[model samples]
Target: MPGPVSLAEQVKEVWTSDEGSMAKDTASNRWPKIVQGMVDDVAETAATAVDRPQQEEALSIQAALKEIKDDMLQNRVLRPLPSDGRDDIDGYNERLEQLGGKCTWLACPWLFGECYLYRRVQTIFALTHHWRDYDIFKRQKDSTFAKSCKAVEELSARYMQVIANSTLPGDATNEEARKLLFVEMTEVALWGNATDLSLLSNLSLDQIQSLQGREAIAKSQRNIVDNDTDAVWQYLSSPLRFNRRIDIVLDNAGFEFFTDVIYAAYLLESGLASVIVFHVKDFPWFVSDVIAADVESLFQHLESASIFPNRSFIDQVVPRLRAHFDSGAMSIKQHSFWTTAYSFHQMKALAPGLFKSLQVSSMVIFKGDLNYRKLTKDGLWPHTTPFKDAIGSMGAESGIKVLALRTNKSDTCVGVESQERVDALNEEAPHGVWIRNGKYAVVSFSDGEKTDGK
Candidate 1:
């Protein structure tokens, strides 16, 4: 029998950056900070434990988290993941082994290394009896969500109005109005990605306001580096789109997810999609990535009187949102494939079930920077590469219509129409800011329009 293909041969190089990009900074800095957060959370929780065993469990996890941080600080070799009985473990271990088991925290591929850090953290808790179901990042996710009261309240009011207006005669019946609303709601979901806790560990309320405030929405629309919302709107508005299902590969848990839920409601209200399905991680991941439980937490926050201080808005919105899930018009599915380190190109092969499942949806929207990175195999393509080409087989003609609503927060950028524009942005702005900073975004869509590789 033949052996597995090498990682080098997988996609040229799973490129790791030491400078000029987010990965460099992430490896050297952000990662240690993330682990430190875990250590601190576990330590604090351990102090107030209910029993000696539980306290001991928390203490052990905290010590393990400290070791992971130390490994990064020391640039120690990447270790194969210990068995946790999860199916994705083999894939991660195989990749680590393929690197000769010698790749270090800072020296290895950035995407893989970053993902491994999260997976490593999960195993520490996964193997423990008391800490098995714990999410160390929950406090941060909840804290950030609380800070987003401004955007949350605004969106609740907007959602209530949209739901009300949607029922009126001739409201949004015109093509222009529908498309206009599409841009508005899509940008809401897009900019909400800016408050990502994994990247901005110390995100402030002012910073969160700057990213998600209603007043800034129109001005920030210009920062979408590659605007493909028109294409997504075109496809979703097509005659064939009637009664079709839409899927969102969800991103963050707090305010970003609130916008996603709002967007899902917009889809059903506008008659663009009959059903909305959310794909969430099975376990805690990447700091703020939505696990299945966060969906309920989001709704609880929405319904919280203290959080909003405006019962009228959430009262108008929350019940209808809950009704969709109850009525099967909207659903959430957790697949282990999402939590895996494998790039999306490997999906069809490594995660055949997920690939087939996604193929049936009218459109599969991959959310946030990490999903975008996995879709593009972590910045492997040139700036001028077409969105379809950059995503490999998941592109057009794969029977999966992909609408990537990503705020560029890393170096791996593709689908920008002009190299000259990229050059001008780089020259005019601070170094790598256009790509690494969450200020810019891309609304990339792919269908059978381009026939290069697919």
Candidate 2:
């Protein structure tokens, strides 16, 4: 796990005037102050949220939004300062305004108002409301992750049904079984949305898969217990297999880590991998994106399970994971792949070798929402765009099985079919509410389309 630099540290860096072709403004002098003021407002608001609770928190969040709107209007943030034509500061500014408006909508308790990032960004803009603002963030806040969550639930139920029949076609030692297992595994990989929120709730994979029977939930829990993940277990239990390594493209660190650990434990128990590597960003990324420090935070939470309201459940799962970590079934390593400077395209240029290195691994899981956004390039493609097409060249070329399980957050999306479905969703849903609500999702997969004739 990586640690994020303090807000003060980030302020020092972004606030320093820099002049270059890529600089947002042609002149550096004025930009730094404007950027710093916004940063200061955010920092202050974070402090207020932390210090205050209950009713007071709402005011703090609103105050932060006001600061962003004010800065945008006063600083001419809507206008591009100066950059190569390739970089759209103006478009980005407009997007930010839209994003800010969406945040304001997220403040509504009736929606995903509890989401920290949405609330924080909303705070920044609610105080500044741009005249042309179309409540972009509001549209997003109402939609986003909601779709994926529903999709995963549906898929989980389907998987559970298949598993229950015992006629799942892949259970036998027959050749046909092997093939079916491969498809099942691939499906599992597909659902690896690296950022889906379903796992965070009680919606575990087994539960999703066993969505039948009067005791479906209990059955899922049982499956979690009875499943002999020794092979995957061995890898996760003692991941450094003398020569093997595993890589985890991380997501959010807190409770999300718990779900990830459960999966890691399964991989280790099943003998699917060895050596766990975690990739993280070098800076404060996408608001609550995981940095390395989250590892410790996760450990503390697991260690003191008694403190959690769901202590009994925690007690059952935490020990298995701890045993794996303690026994060296797992090891954690980090890389700064999630920074603003390294677009997926840029990653191709700068770290082709690193990705190539990862290609050798038995499995690599990219976690969480930001990675999904980056993978898809945050475009305005039609909802039905194929997942592979949206990810462009990088996703297609990698000789790895890339599975993306993401609840929608940004504008770019894929996996839906029909303009009618999209229009119906838009008409029935509120504003740009689809993206923010997490109602849509994509269990996208790409096999790295190896054309080398291996």
Candidate 3:
């Protein structure tokens, strides 16, 4: 067999080439807009700064934002991060130094550079006195959620019905029904990934609605080229159901997050999980990845009849969701490790606290393409590499159970049964177009049981 494909090799592919693909678009288009958005926010907020020192701080942030934008457009080398007391900053700076102190915008490893961009943007706020709590992406995140009202209403109604019909745990008579609902809910979460802001930047209201709901999911079932929902259900329904905590490392907010919450609600209500922990990013990341604030924002939106335009649906769902939050059946958490350059494979060595936290959970679900990429080290694995092998250290028996629900939006993937399936997919759409489009998906699971003592 050939040696593992390195990030150096992967970067030369069309996916990361400066010509096209989301990576190119992100570097060329999204990064400038992101910096400009922050500049605008700084300007807007400066008007309200009460003191001269605060006004000066806001001005400094604006200056930094301009520099950030210029650096991206010019493809300038990534600069070292100033000390921010966060543990991850040193790690980022270390990586920057290791990359010859000159990793350019369009040429660096896509995953690392993308993460670095967010971290660099965040450093501006960290250094500020008056703007530490400001979220530059808040307007976009809120607007996107507001636009997703239709899909939110539809999923809310469906979720309520599923909860109503779900059987209590250990009900042998309803086993098949519960399993079926598991598949449905997992698919709902999977397809929710189709609308990430970083990639599908121009999705209209109709386009978003078309990607959601039961009918859309039914129509797109054939697109799930690699599914392990049965394995997921089997794990959840296992006999060793004592310490049942389900941890979700979240992805994009708005509709996707809305779906994930309902899925967690179902798991709690149906007794599949005793508690649910949502792991969110500590800062604005990948434009739309959830932060802890988004959970409350989602609930606030759901509770507003004016925003959702479905009083009955909101009434049915909001209270139960609130109950979960109130009773601590559901909780949201964040850690610096989530936004760091290190992948999940390095979690144990780099972020042991987080790894230890996950080790105790019954199941940990990694959502969307980025997490899947990080889980697999963002390397181009042979198409037939087992999901467990692709994940490296995280797949060891001593590690935590992991389930990846991802829509294929990147080149890296594993755990398909055969290479022939990949060939057929390529024949359908040559030159790897089939994988980059969000139409295809994978529901991959790893038992996290060590076969050999590594």
Please name the candidate that would achieve the greatest TM-score relative to the true structure.
Answer: 1
Which whole-number lDDT from 0 to 100 does residue 9 have in model 1? 40
Candidate 2 lDDT tens digits, 285-397: 34445556556656664455243443444455556667887887775665544443223544656567776766776555666555766565544455666555556555556
lDDT of 1 by residue, 32-146 (tens): 8988988888888888887899998887887888899999899899888899988888989999888899899878888888888889888898999988999888999999998
Using alpha carbons, what is the TM-score of model 2? 0.52
For every model shown, what is its TM-score relative to the native structure? 0.90, 0.52, 0.87
Candidate with more favorable, higher TM-score: 1 or 2: 1
**Model 3: ten consecutive residues of lowest lDDT:** 197-206
For residues 131-242, write the lDDT of model 3, one tens digit per residue: 7877878878888888888777777777777776565454554575566566667777888854432221122223323434324435546677777777788777776537
| CA-lDDT, candidates in order | 0.79, 0.44, 0.78
- Give the residue spans of candidate 1 off by over 4 A: 1-14, 165-173, 195-220, 240-242, 448-454
